[model samples]
Target: MPSLTNQDWKDLEDSIKAAALTLGYDEAVWDGNGVLEVEGKDWEELTEEQQKAAEILGMDEDDWDEDDEGLRYEDVDWNKLLPEVKDAAINFGYTEETWEGDGEIEVEDKDWDELTDSEKAAALVLGYTEDTWED
Candidate 1:
């Protein structure tokens, strides 16, 4: 093939890719709107124009064979999953205390008006009552 400048190579590669897509060539694909790959085809077999075009495409030299596979794009559904993912994140974040501290008071299995005076005194005996607790 003849020599090609950078811009020439770029335009040629674009033309080849457009032709490949229009011809529905299997295993022929365009990547990044500029690079084209043709399986089982040789740079020489392309018309002299093609070889020069590919060169002008500024696409660096690359090779492929019949064994080469094609690229594919797939779609996904995020609408159904996003809400559940957000909710789970919120549920995982739910907590009462945000600080790390020792000697903090925590009441469990105790209700107001249920403790007898003696139980209350026993609680105070164990330092369960705060010094400034209000009625």
Candidate 2:
């Protein structure tokens, strides 16, 4: 068996604290360093209780699996992207509007106040509601 170093003990303690909160065991709390204290229960008794809880939740801590381990973001390739090439690809074949409608001029030349309520609604992506458009 691998002995848990002081850091590992602390990590385990923090994990238990987080689990209790997430699972709504609101009566429980842990010292910042990871010692557990249930609402009316003893902190020293938690080793046993923690195991039983894990068992009831179908976790076999001794059966170390891939999900038990993970890597930190610090180990990632942060600069794998080049921004200049990305911007150029996005500008490919970009077209400007000439309205191309029989009776309507291009949108860029229109006075916003001259448009109808439905047109205003469309302009704001249907976001123009009484509460939102009040200003």
Candidate 3:
């Protein structure tokens, strides 16, 4: 791919932010250091039934911390989840292909700076961080 100019990078970042917002994310920001920070609804933000379901799936209270950047349905260990929780996750639009052991949850085998805009945005939405891309 051709190198992206600064303006192109800016536009790409803007698009990512727009996508996040359209998807109902609470916050999205590119830190100008190869990291796109995103925050979504935390566990506490979920309904009581949702919290109970998460708990039944082995998630703890600490897992719901706002500082943890909220849960990513794709990162759940399907094999470990209660059958009902798995059903709920699937019903919520998470595919079995997104199960934790199905593939890497974080980007790998590429330098952070080398990632395309779409890749960065996808990783960000999945809760990846700057430390996740460290060599």
Segments in model 2 whose C-alpha atoms lie over 4 Å from true places? 1-46, 64-67, 72-135
User: By descending TM-score, how would the candidates be arranged?
Assistant: 3, 1, 2
Q: Write the per-residue lDDT of candidate 1 for residues 55-123, one digit (tens) a residue.
A: 544433463212222111101122222343323322323112311122223332345345456545534
If both were scored by lDDT, which would come out higher, candidate 1 or candidate 3? 3
Top lDDT prediction, candidate number? 3
Best by TM-score: 3
* Residue range 1-135, candidate 3, lDDT tens digits: 011112232455554445433423323222112222222357567666555544543355576443543234333345645465455445433456755546543435667687677666655544455555452
TM-score of 1: 0.23
lDDT of 2 by residue, 1-135 (tens): 122221222455555545545423432112111122332243333466554554443444543221212111111122321233222212321121211122423432445575465445443431222333333
In model 1, what lDDT does residue 107 have? Answer: 34
For all predicted structures, in order, the TM-scores are: 0.23, 0.19, 0.31
Lowest summed-lDDT stretch of 10 residues in model 1?
A: 69-78
Models, CA RMSD each: 27.0, 21.1, 17.8
Q: Give the lowest summed-lDDT range of ten residues in model 2.
A: 66-75
